[model samples]
Target: MLAVLASVFVISMSGALMPGPMFATVLAKSYKSPWAGAQVSLGHAVVEVPLILLIYFGAATILENDITHLILGIVGGGMIIWMGLGMLRARKAYAGGTKDTPYNAFTAGIILSAGNPFFIIWWATVGALLVLKIADYGLGGLTALVLTHWAVDLIWLSIVSGLVYKTHRLWAPALHEAVFVACGLLLMGFGGWFVVSGVLAIG
Candidate 1:
């Protein structure tokens, strides 16, 4: 049980640590309102709650479906690339110090999160492994799983928000632009890899 929890914690932390649209929005919001940034993080977490449950509960059948994995891998890869390019393009606008609208920030976080294929892949694969492994422990195991994931998200998001709040000057428009550009490239490279791999498998 301890081992299971540790594994889930590590996976959760890794995913949260990745700089995606959600992370970027949190940082941007931190510049304006830390509470709001937290709220945004909460909103993303709320979505994950259901997503995680669904993936865990369906792991057995879901993993058996080759076509499902193929589609997920392909879509996930494409989404990452799209987001990466978008982030790169937004660098200029971000560096210019544009004000963030509450609606825009919230919407951006939710949309990016919803469209994120990496989240789907992670939950479907690593998430499935943990949930299934601990399923024998019943509700207690399930609770631990959820809690660990939530804890990882809470800690990481708070850190991200805090960084922006505490170091807004250091995280000027230029810094934001640079961060996005770097994240974007990472996403693109990884996403492209997934897409290509999926295609080869299908072929």
Candidate 2:
């Protein structure tokens, strides 16, 4: 059980550290509110919790189906591409220092996460495997795995948000815009990869 928890923490943190849609969203929102990352993580948990439960209840088979993966890949990839374009357009607004429309950070988190095919795929594979291992120790192990995974997300995202908030003034506008553009590009790249992978899988 101890090993399971430790492994979960390490793996979860590794995923969290990667630059994904959620990470990009956190960086964009962090400039406005230090709590943005936590809010986003909470929203992410909203989707994750249910999915985890589903996996625990033996819904892994559905996730593993090639057809299901193809559908998720197409839909999720399209959504991610749309988000990336939105972020690019928002770069001007960000540079102009215009206040963004009132929105719920938590909800944004959930949407970004739900739209990410990689996130779903990870849970279907790596996450499912972890769950199976933890299942050996019964419910207690499962509980530990889930909690540890979420805790890592919360801590890491909070730190990132706080850091961005604190350092907002230090970065030049051009530098900030550049960073945003880079994040947007990374997202688009991932989105394209997902689409291609899905197509290949279907073929």
Candidate 3:
């Protein structure tokens, strides 16, 4: 059990530390509020909880379907690429002192997450495997896995958001722009990969 929990923690952390739409959203939100990442993580939990349940209840088969993967990959990949471009555009607007309207960080989290096909794929594959391994221990194991994984996300994202908030004043505008640009590029790269994979699957 301890080993299971530890494994979940490590794997979850590895995912959380990856550069993706969620990370981009959190970084963007952190500029406005240090607690934004927490809100985002909570929103992430909203999607994740149901997903975990579905996997536990044998919904993994549906998620594993090639058609499902193809559709999600195409749609989600396009959305991610769009978001990346939006971020790039936002940088110029931000430099011009135009601020975006206030929105719920939680919602941003949900939207960003739901729009990422790679995220869905991960749960469908690697996450499903983990679920099977842990399901042997019953509901207790599932619960621990969910909670531990979420806790890791919350902790890591909170730290990132807090650092960005705290250091915003110390960082130059150019530095901020560069970070945003880098994130945007990474998102586009991921999006492109998803699209290519989807096409291959379809073929």
Candidate 4:
């Protein structure tokens, strides 16, 4: 059980560390207001907790349904592309200023995290894997997996917020914009890939 739990923790942490629109948003907000970025990160994880539980508990049956995976894949992919586009648009508006409010970051984090489609697919797949192995470890594994995943998220957000707080003055607007655009492109590329893969799987 301990080994299984440890393995899941590592997997969860690796997945959380993968850069995405969520990470970019956290970093951007951190540059403007570190506290706000932290808040946003917390809110994002808060939303994810229930989702992970749902997926873990339900994926066993959920994955068996073609319709479920199809809807999830399409929705998730579309959402990533949309968020990438949004970031691109936001580049100019937020580049030079700290005027963006914490509430804005909080709200955006919640909405984007909640609406993200790729997360849905990934969790659904991973959740199924957990469910299969869950019986081998019982409640202890479950608890550890959940805790470790959230901890990773908190740590990542803190790092972003701390770095921005410490170095915001030195960070140039152009560099920020460039980062945003690059992240946006990466998101769009992944989204497109998901859509294509999902379609191929369905066909």
Model 4 misplaced stretches (Cα beyond 4 Å) = 40-47, 55-59, 98-103, 107-118, 131-141
Best candidate per lDDT, number?
2
lDDT of 1: 0.66
Ranking by lDDT: 2, 3, 4, 1
Please give the lDDT score at residue 64 for candidate 4: 42
On residues 144-169, what C-alpha lDDT tens digit does candidate 1 reach at each position? 88888887877787777777777766
Query: What does candidate 4's lDDT look like per residue over 1-203, in tens digits?
Result: 66666777788778768777677667766766667556766777777767766766664456445565566557767876776776667766656673443246677567556555556566667755764576557667677777766777777778787887788678677886786677667767766766676666667
Clashes of each: 0, 0, 0, 1
Candidates 2 and 4 compared: the better one by TM-score is 2
Compose the digit string of candidate 3's lDDT tens values, residues 35-138. Answer: 98899999989988898899999998787777876886788778767766777778755433466423567887776676666677789889998898899999
lDDT of 3: 0.80
Model 2, runs deviating above 4 Å: 101-104
| Evaluation by TM-score, superior candidate among 2 and 3 | 2
> Which tens-of-lDDT digit does each residue in 1-203 have in candidate 2?
88878889889988889877778778878878899889999999999988888899899878767777687778877877776777777876864558552445798787767766667778999999999988888878778888899999999999999999899879987888887787678767777777777777768
TM-score of each: 0.69, 0.91, 0.89, 0.75
Clashing pairs in 2: none
